[model samples]
Target: MHNDDLSRFFSENMAVDGELSFQQWEGKVLDFAQRVSRGNCKGLALVSSGGTSVPLEMNAVRFVTNFSTGSRGAGLVEDLVVREWACILLHSESAQLPFRRVMDNMDTERFFTELMAPEKSSAVASIVGTYSKYKTRLLLVPYRTVVDYLYLLRLITVAVCHRAECLRTMPMVLLAAAAVSDYFIPRTLLSEHKISSNDGMTVHFSCVPKVLNVLSDIWHTADCDVSRLFVTFKLETHDEMLETKALKNLTLYNCDLVVANKLQEYKERVVMYWRDTPGSPTVLQRPPNGSIESLIVDCILRRIECDATGGGRS
Candidate 1:
């Protein structure tokens, strides 16, 4: 979008106070703004979950999708909420939720088959009940298409970027684990009707614009404040390519940290690379007594705490 268009876009979205999701999101941002203005609340986060789909037809019967169960993102939300952090969860419409699905099925490997057991009924009910009671703490916004995700992300990113009006500025963290599509057929070139299989068609693909540079530079709580921290995840199956791609992402996107994980061993291990740390990367192993998800949550929380204390330098 052009400069005027982007400015108008932000203005139009910032005016949306009646929408329930926007209201919930705005409430968290506004509260954090107030608290940070008084040096009270410290951490605020925006999390994106699930994979984005690229529609191949204007009618939208079929589409190309990316690979993601959204389990990691959902788990992050669950842990962050229980730790009393304000989070905005932007997830796919078809994705599993943190408390409702992830909590009910603690055995992530086996899926929800355990919940089908008669002995687990009460435990499941208790978790759902608790979520329903405190659901207001989470601002869940669902997006199906890639376009929808990008638009909503732009809106939320701009909305939370208010000027730090006091001595303290709240630490804003972006934990983007969503699997977005690499290429798609633009809407203008999409077929209006379904193509017949008898006539084989060769589809053309175009690159989807990566917005991390725009995010790091334009999306901020204040001008030249350096208060926002971005943490991105890199998944690769090729062992030789993992470190190169992860480090490339950090440099290319201008993010604060890049997590490199092999697709096969992601759940068991991950290496965290800090932007300012020039030497050894932190190698995190999943605890035998606990899960890797919990360990990651703790690491992120500690980083946020450090950022809040050091005026957003962590």
Candidate 2:
């Protein structure tokens, strides 16, 4: 694409809801990128979580959103952080947060009530240590709208892909688990103020372009010899179509792996479609009384470690 075409593509595709917040969040991302450059963090993982919203009006009295709760992605962040990987968690403001889910049950008032309980002591100490050790390593970059999510994702993804090639010695990973919106009311189509129900309504929205293609190309070139392991999730409501859609994404986006699961079985099992492996892919199952986090984390770490050692794509 020519320079003019490239510029026009972005402008017409994603229009921001709040320009100020987008710019402010971008500054934060730049600072994070600078920090990564100077740190000795062995690996860098950018994990996106939650669902994105589309504003119906400029003031946004009403909007559209997906059904994602962000549990899987947030869990992934916790697993990586616990293993000491430098993490950038780009999550929705309403989504689940790493460690906080556990701490939410360990409320401060409830804690003080049982302040000296021996059982609570261990759990309390663990939480304190996790926060203390990971405060500097795990950075949270939250988003509210689809526009904010896309803009921030582009900024961080491009920054990492561009910089990793030049200076990174450790492996980099991009895990996009967000259930992004495929349709949205463009800025030009949105009303300046909320529409009143007195008129009853019909709205026109446009398809939102996916940015995975750009990231894959940016990080895949021979000139950019950055070792990376990219993974994405595919959630399907239809059991029969799960594998088919996952396979399609695995090829279309050129991802290293795609975690495909039906909504009913999402928490219990995830079928992984491998890009490097030839025949069938692996199905990671949670035992009758097991934690799926361990299984998921183990699979990801195995792939990431392989690429890091193999010196490039694995």
Candidate 3:
């Protein structure tokens, strides 16, 4: 994407409805990144989760969204926190959250009743204690719309770039697991009010810019020695196109790794294409007792460690 296009996109979309002002959100991210830089953490991971919505009208009564529960991203953050890594989680407001999904399967009434019961008090304590342990290391930033997601993501990278000196010695990874919308109706094109349901409606959608391109070409090249690794995900329905698309994304985006999953088998298997290990795609299977995210995080950290030790790409 051209710089002009990006500038125009942000200029038009950044002012959309949000709970926090852009300046306030930027400050939050900066403060969190600074804390991570000063702490004795294993590394820093900027993880994006969930699906974004594209509003059909300026009033936004109706929108288009995808089926991303953010389970993988939430699981990755949980695993990263367990390994002592500082994480900045940029997620959809409605996405599944780390540590909170443990009891997500239970009915709300039953969950509360069980928690208040003497027998399940220990479970409550365990959950609370785990969140407390990592509260200082994990930062949660929530967004709803595609515009919000892109804006927050850019804000985060810029903040980290600003703290480059303090974070120079640490490994940084950008994990883009969010299932973002591929098309959106820009503010200029959206109707001022919600469309009436009396008749069928036809809406035109503009293509959302390829954010990975911007991330790789701009954010990753910030003037610093921060060892930044960019990883993106590809979800495909066709099994035959999985590896090919994953490799294509790895090269096209200048990413360090691409994690590809099939819609049907994503919970059970993934194919990873590593930049350093060309032509050898690794297939990862979920362990019987653990999540696939745990394995993915292990692979990421190992690659980061290898690079740090001069065993991988410089």
Worst 10 residues of 2 by lDDT: 1-10
Please give the TM-score that candidate 3 achieves against the real structure.
0.93
> Model 2, range 1-314, lDDT digits (tens) per residue?
23344345557645454544566765566577667657767677889999999889888899889757788887888778778778889999988888776656566887566566656566667877787777677889898788678777876776666644433565677888998998887777788897998987988888776777666665554243446777888888997698788888878888888888888888998888888772487888888866675687788787767665675533
Q: Runs in model 1 with CA error above 4 Å? A: 1-42, 103-122, 129-133, 163-168, 220-227, 311-314
Q: Which candidate is the best by TM-score?
A: 3
Q: Pick the candidate with the highest lDDT.
A: 3
Better of 2 and 3 by TM-score: 3
Q: In candidate 3, which residue pairs clash?
A: none
Q: For model 3, what is the error of residue 287's alpha carbon versus the real structure, in angstroms, after optimal superposition?
A: 0.8
Candidate 1 Cα lDDT to native: 0.70
Compose the digit string of candidate 3's lDDT tens values, residues 161-246: 65445666778888999998999987888888989999998888889998788777765776765467899999999987987888
**TM-scores of the candidates in the order shown:** 0.79, 0.86, 0.93
Per-residue lDDT over 94-182 for candidate 1, one digit per residue giving the tens place of the 0 to 100 score: 78787877464467644466546656567666777767754655677788777667667766676676433432345667888888888
**Once superposed on the true structure, which residue ranges of model 2 sit more than 4 Å away at CA?**
1-10, 13-17, 24-27, 34-40, 105-121, 164-167, 222-226, 288-290, 311-314
User: With candidate 3 superimposed using the best TM-score fit, by how many Å does residue 292's alpha carbon deviate from the native?
Assistant: 0.5
Q: List the residue pairs that clash in candidate 1.
A: none
Name the lDDT of candidate 2.
0.75
